[model samples]
Target: MKLQKGWKLLSSAALAVVLALTGCSQTAAPTQPGTEATTGQTPQDDGGQADMTAMLRLNLKTEPPSLDPPKGFDTTSNEVLNATMEGLARLDKDHKPQPAMAEKWTVSEDGKTYTFTLRDSKWSNGDPVTAQDFEFAFKRILDPNNAFPSAFLAYYIAGAEEYNTGKGNADAVLVKAFDDKTLEVKLNAPAGFFTHILTQPTFFPVNKKVVESNSKWAENASSIVTNGPFKMEDWVHDQSIKIVKNDGYWDKDSVKLAGINWFMVNDENTQYQMYKTGQLDKVSSVPNDMKKQLIDSGEAKVDSDASIYYYRMNTKMPPFNNVNIRKAFALAIDRQSLIDNVVQGKQTRALAHVPYGFPEPAGGDFREKGGDYLKDNDIEQAKELLKKGMEEEGWTTLPLVTMTYNTSDGHKAIAQVLQEMYKKNLGIEIKLESKEWKVFLSDQRARNLQFSRSTIPADYGDPINYLELYVTDHPGNRINYSNKEYDALVEKIRNTADETERFKLMHDAEKIFMDDMPLVPIYFATKIFMDQPNVNGIVRHPVGTTDYKWAEVRKK
Candidate 1:
């Protein structure tokens, strides 16, 4: 209660709670699950320049660690990669695949072969982009040594997983360049969402020559070679990255803004102030106190994200090793209270792992069909479960549990609220711990914490991505959760071509996941942001991503 009062006082004063904030503590910049190292110092000018007025000005939640496609897994790097690199396909406003680098293609009747023909395109450095570039980039990502996080998404390609795991020869890895313009791929099985998979940044091509000639090619702003709507023109570490329109882009004529200036402002208050002072034209998020006011005035926008915030229990660790104990914790959390009092953003209470908006092949949303799996703040049931779990374990007293999370003001507030909830409802005390982003991920992957705050963003539009997370062998299954039935259903969903059957398998897998109570579902997130009035054509997807390729800035 005291902490909540203090936070309310801070908000009432238009101030954020003072919290420790630091970039990834690596000597270099931090790296997220699917991203590269983000370490670089501000660079002096390298001759490339563009007019400021012609550039779109926006603020970044944090500076991205690396822009290399294979390692660009996080949202920050995705923003730059989406703008500066062209994949074989890109997502349209409706989140459907649209042609980009590849003009057209065909698949074999067996649904195992794909042939892609490259369009006439050149890199920003005037080098030709060929079918070999795509072939090389794909092979590089599948290389066992690289171990890119999203490499599994490409496992549908014949020999991809084998090559990635070093179980098969690289030469047998099915992707081949038939000519300067034609590329062929053989898949192990047909993936209904394969085209959408190509739209991911990890599938974007890299110039083999540029990467080989200079290993640090992507680190420097000016030397970075790209084949997209814009090219990196300048980068000042911890300050901003500047990109300008690429004259050599295949569809350069459609490019609206000549450039974009992306400022790295991790502090929410600083970002809001910059927007207010006209130093920034847009911010990815706004202060909670200002969110409603801005929305009421039509200066802010809110959109749902295909994401779920949850807490993964360390099943391999004590106390949580019992399923009933896990259920007790899951049932005790007051998701509505957390959202209404703490988050104060447009967010929906999450009863299941998957968010509410993801599409189902036959028709409606996944969450709508599955319905709620757990009730809210069932204190009596929670206490009963805790008592039963203790009795089962033959313990007279419960052990102390520690909850860990990455550092952020908002996260701290959320953690505090949860701490109080558990203490109040279950009489179980939770010790809180904080670490830098990279370290936090490292610990989570190693299962070094008792309970950890975590989230899974949908890699594609499929519920399988969420279901696959807890599969016995999945690397993303950080909690070491495993159930034979759950694993079998996940595999069944992949091979079951029938949409109805696949949906059933997916639901069954989720049911097993929830029954085990390996994780506590908190809330489905929403993006609430503020943008300058004149900014037009910006595409904000409920996926929590922004596509600026077609964005236009016009004088009002």
Candidate 2:
């Protein structure tokens, strides 16, 4: 969904005011362990377990695809790999931009250039992480042959587009190493949210020597290097991956946990069972049946995430090419009912393109700003649109369509709800297909699967992070949706330095998308999990990395 030009300006101004009031310098650093108090005792000492070492076990749905920071973007991989790699910037409890490996930075007045002063950090292999490492990592990911799905993060960098297109030398890009500790980047245009973008792993510096020396680097557990709070110790693909605290980490003294064991369990039933048996620390996307059990046991804790689960129609296909049909499909489903019944009221219904609390912009109601385009449950209107679409296109029978989802019970239940809704409300038949999570992800990226389930995590704390996914030519635009007007607005927001003007443009662009119904809004995710009571300092950030850095485990 696009934001209106006027709203974009107002939103930007609002953000600026909020940032100023909050005192941007007070932003917390990414997860760091508890440090000693000025009183000469560490925080962990209060519990009389100053030397205690705890092992936290996690149950994951799938193994990470890769440990290489530059190549890992998928949620499964990101959750695990993020603990091992340090980015130039980190997302704090509020998902605000903060320092990480880079101690501080300066942005030019034109907003097209950023110079960062790096902290003296060493890789797990004892090699110094220099500014050149970042330059090399950035250029390599932009290589067209690499087919990095996240190349768009660097598109703002000067010469990045040419480098990614194979039209210019990779070294010609804006990133440069002034020395071992200083790095500079030149952007093609002003990008207001560029600092937040740097928090992504794609921009994280890597040890060039380590990656080049190992031919199978990042492919397996042993071939990777760690620069963050933890180091991967063992990885049995599709089974479990283990990590231990990194003593070599710069702030090792603050790290309290000794180890973490991540188990890969695809079945929700098995995961729930593990948690019940006290073998797992946390499990997300709990099943309907298990929710009551966890709640009764006082183990259920629900956290609302700033993510949207939606179904994208392949606009490039024949039947879906018509916008009316797309709107009809959108209007047919009852989003509120879906949230209440299918999701068991665990999630909130999405009305606007931007999910609430994202970037937590001040003084603007996104729902009101969405205008009248937001689709609500109206079976009669949907049928009318569908009838007109079929008549205009010379079609009488509904097309045979397949709705795909992951092999989890929750997804299976959701797909069934959609299938029943489409058939009963619109007389449209939709076959349900479920595949393994990895296969489903692959199919989505290739655009080979139609009408599939997808979720977008907030990259930064901004609405634009989610909005940009729908931009024309975006790698994540799996539905092949392209609107020239929307594309133009996105470009304008990126280049426009005026904060007020940028937000207005984005808000207007969002209205156009909500009106088009290129995607069927499902519900905002509600993550339910249970953690030990001793897990303190584990603040839940709605966006970005979900890890424990500032947290310390104290004995009860």
Candidate 3:
């Protein structure tokens, strides 16, 4: 009760709180997501004398899980996909959706239907891009056989969830390509952020003809067909991927650099050395040990990132099945100190999962308006909760516990810090385990892991993007959390139509989730990295991935 007074609203077997807000239609122009970055440095005027042959070199911390847009849910893959693929709409530097493949579009007066008019764009293979590509892409993402984790992004389309969950036929999904250049999509209801959500790579149109002919079209450069500013020239598996400017692109004249050579180097120290030696123009991460010094010396840049680093406990398993235990674990960590002393990124201490940089549906900052849902490092409360949970489980001795995280220097350090905090606060010693990224994600989806490190970067601007995954058995809901009330609140938020009322429902849902404490949120992310002096025009969207579409390099 330190922040907002969140009281339980229940009376045996009925609804506790009556939502007073009336439903009103969502405004046609919704508030856009925030896109504040360490940017104001404009590109230098080279008077058409900029180097056109050089590739702007950069590093990725790890190899992407897959280059296929449907399977590419992680940052590593989507960062590359965002550069190579063209969606009907793309978020510009302002973080507002703008026309890309689609030259123009219209929303029905009721706002439930969308019609896109495509431009004459050519794929990297010189094939003309058609509306069919989009129709195929949308259905492909929602296809259960594909098992794409981001498939929920398509649930906005009418009948999509039914088809995705194997209950309805593909033909029932209401998205169709009327002709070569026109496509139509009908949603279950009006979502003002529909276009904003469409800006994601999951919505990027793939060449239907190419994909039908080759299953591994995105795996290698030779088989790839992209319609964006760049085309893959070579891919060396876990080593590197090189992309060159696509001359066949619809707006090829706007592209500046000849290409981008993305090197995969997971070790931050090695990447830092490479950047120092001029082998890399930009680094994906800063060594945790050296971050404070780098930030203090003005050598590193901090940009706002809409990501939340948290811990997920399997709600169906063991001692954590107790709500009090989950809340105890959550309150044990000192998030401010973790960010200030250990992480050393200018990240915001997350009191809620929605994070900053997102606008509430009606207007105003969501995090600020939501108030603090989770308590900050209340050691006394944590101890009380732990004792209560242990007694409630009828055990003087606790079950064996473990915390799992994927392999990374920073991750290992964070786990160690958290382990010590838990021991100090609740007198619990949890074992720590590290696994390779693929194995880690596999274990998480299988529900084989007990307690694990988890993070979520908002896929779109809406707060529901952060809240909806927990809906009963949603693909992204790996924690096995299910509550009838919370699910109903989210369902209402999705279809409510009234922006302010919807936001209230979202906030109410989050309050219930935090009170249940299935997961522990640590801090919201801010990207801290170093860049070469000559690099320019890189647009890093807070809601999406880094874009090099308008990037250029000045001859030094």
Candidate 4:
């Protein structure tokens, strides 16, 4: 998934109006402690009982591949990075951009330039945070040599994509620090959602001194220097990670919790056991069979996530190189059955690349206007398409294909269903393979997989975010799918300021994309979990993962 949060407001002027009218009621949440926790800060024995209120214990779905924000693209690493890093702006409960290191910022009338005024803040090591740090970070993200997976997010800035793609020079990219306290940015075009882009961890500044001295600075707890509300205290690789409140934070006085302990447990059943045994305060994944039971017992929680799970076919590879072949696989799957039998929750069946929920600007929803492009299961039609595609290739029998996915119980189940579906419907046999999340991503990027499962949550609440992924050279376009018409439409949306017109172009583009069927859209995701009632103040974003910066463990 493109694991970063994004917001879609009309424009910079409208954003200011909304913020001023809303009265900042979303001020930081006050941290509080529960009477006891499953695990947390080292207990100073009060006779025999350990005081748990001062600590929070949560389970991570997977061990983080890397703590370096730019390189970390999975939800597991993103969740950890969000708590331990501070960016120019942070998202409040409402997904609106809130002040963080940058006390306030303003955009020019032309909407091409942004000026940010910094507040007094320091790193965990007590060194003053400066505007220069941000300048360095933003430029580094656009540096081709860095090979940042999320470099596309910063492309809105002037010359960023050009610089990152080696078409322009670093100095030509218009991000600069005018002084110790002021940072200025010039964009190639007007960007209404740019502020929310800064809330992503990829935009967070790193301590220049610390990162320069140690190549693996972020990988070790002792060497990391962050400016967020919490700082890493210890890390037991693949076992647990411990964090303590940062005393040097600008708003330290407002923070209440002493520490948070995150345990690494990939199995949902194990996490459920830990929560039931009172060794964890929050569990992210609940066992599929136990989902209903946990919710009935008032232990499980569910929230609609702005995400989609899909299967990507390497359009550059044989057999799949034919568009008809792609359409056959996409049309063969019974998405409703997949959701009902495999992915039970509030997950919506995805018939289009962009999920439902984003506004259409004038009225209604963007999805309401576009409607469904992909159809439900049609086995006969799928068979005809596959047969036609095979005939075009002048082959009676094709090589066996393999579908790949990350290691997980739910993923395994979905793969099996698809494997059977294709065999029964199209008379084709495809094998299944699973790898750890990190390995799977690397293999997918290299286009080593013939067919594979891929997912993307909106980095921001816009149709363009999802639509842009299919552009000819987009970093996330791992399937090697490309179309001139699709690329033109994406560019049109980015440059057009009128929402209604942009929506029409996007809707048209989506139709063209579905017609080609480079990827098979499955079901949209709904985050389901179980947690103690005391886990409070976790700000949920519309995109990516939730924010734990203001989290508290208040006694219920």
Task: Write candidate 1's Cα lDDT for 266-363 as tens digits.
Answer: 67788889889988867767775455556556667566567888899989887999999999999887676566556766577777787766667777
Write candidate 3's Cα lDDT for 76-119 as tens digits. Answer: 88889988888999888677899999999999999999999999
lDDT of prediction 2: 0.71
- lDDT: which candidate is best? 3
The TM-score obtained by model 4 is 0.88
The parts of candidate 4 lying over 4 Å away from their true place are 1-53, 296-298
Q: All candidates' lDDT scores?
A: 0.76, 0.71, 0.81, 0.76
TM-score of 1: 0.87
Assess every candidate by TM-score. 0.87, 0.87, 0.91, 0.88
| Tens digits of per-residue lDDT for model 4, 1-556 | 1111121122344223222221111111111011111112221223322223477888876678888878786677888888888888887766778889999999999998999999999999989999998888888888899888889988889989899999997899999999989999998777777887788888889887787788789888888888998899999888899988888888776566788899877787787888888899777677665655555565665665667899998998887899888888888877665554346564666777887657777876676667777666766778888889989998799667889999887787678767767776677889899998888888987778889998787876677889988899788889899999889888888888777787889899999999999988887676666556556666556564577666666643
lDDT of each residue in 105-188, candidate 2, tens digit only: 999988788999988878887888889888888888798888888887788899897888778978789899999989999998
Q: List the residue pairs that clash in candidate 4.
A: 34-53
Question: Relative to the unseen true structure, what is the C-alpha lDDT of residue 145 in candidate 2, on a scale of 0 to 100?
Answer: 83
Model with the higher lDDT, candidate 2 or 3:
3
